[model samples]
Target: MANLSLDSDELLLPRDVVAVDVPASWGGEVSHQLTFAGPLGPILALPGRRTRWLFLARWDTRPHTPPPDVRYWRDRVPAPTAHWVVRPGDALPLVSVIRCAIRTVRP
Candidate 1:
């Protein structure tokens, strides 16, 4: 993926959520991580392949809390998915929205 350049209309400050459109056959390893600031802290996404374009979700990490049940989301979210391990706080709603968007497109 390349830089996410956005037009004036697409720009959203603070929670600057951007979408990177990638081909379906992309299998290259995610050598670099693109992170954005969420409500809590830094949020990162590793996009995975889907039927057409790739999809991404903000994953939060909680050191004190038990690890998230990623196994369940792995299948549903698709391959090459990006996750941001963060404290369970404001990121929850963003993650939920990302998951819901992914679910809507999946078969």
Candidate 2:
């Protein structure tokens, strides 16, 4: 597992999971991108607004290669990957997303 420190919270993520800054064009309002080297593919997390943040997960059987310059491989990527919008002040949804990513990793 990898230790990811966000503010005062530290998240244990899969060792192959990597987070990078998301470009304004692709991220829209998000701050970072989480790329899993597994079937889970990429999971984009938007910055928290006054009430909530968004978590977008994409499933792909093929390996994920992060686009150069923080751009997505294709513009249409977001359309099909718009999977979930976590409710305000809810950490459970985020946990679930993390779990899914973790599960995709192979020992």
Candidate 3:
């Protein structure tokens, strides 16, 4: 929703990963995207509700390739953040950690 400030600690280097804490109401799984224009410049998205989210960290594969973790979010998950780094030879799409919850909490 806003520009992702890239600090020294949050620097997304090559082959690294970061997770974004999305809200349950968002109904993730529609592949949400986190993009960086330049050095924490302009972060953009479709600006609409989605059914999914993606994790760019595990670019090689999704759902199965990466650990079972990044696929979903914890109930007390943190806030969403963007990550970017230079890939030596391949291209990896932006990724976002989709939030999920147990049906017991449904209103």
Choose the strongest candidate by TM-score: 2
Residue 9 CA error for candidate 1 (Å)?
Answer: 31
Worst 10 residues of 1 by lDDT: 27-36
Alpha carbon lDDT at 39, candidate 1:
35
Report lDDT (CA) for all predictions. 0.30, 0.31, 0.28
Count of backbone clashes for each model? 8, 0, 11
**Model 3 agreement with the true structure over 21-42: per-residue lDDT tens digits:** 2233332322222222212212
* Comparison by lDDT, 2 against 3, better one: 2
Clashes of 1: 8
Ranking by lDDT: 2, 1, 3
Instruction: Give the TM-score (vs. native) of candidate 3.
Output: 0.20
Ranking by TM-score: 2, 1, 3
> Once superposed on the true structure, which residue ranges of model 2 sit more than 4 Å away at CA?
1-4, 7-16, 29-61, 71-107
Residue 107 error for model 1, in Å?
Answer: 3.6
Write down the RMSD of candidate 3 (Cα, Å): 14.1
Give one digit per residue, the lDDT tens place, for model 2 in 29-86: 2322223322232333433322222233322334444434432222122222222232
Candidate 2 clash figure, as a count: 0
Task: Estimate TM-scores for all models.
Answer: 0.21, 0.24, 0.20
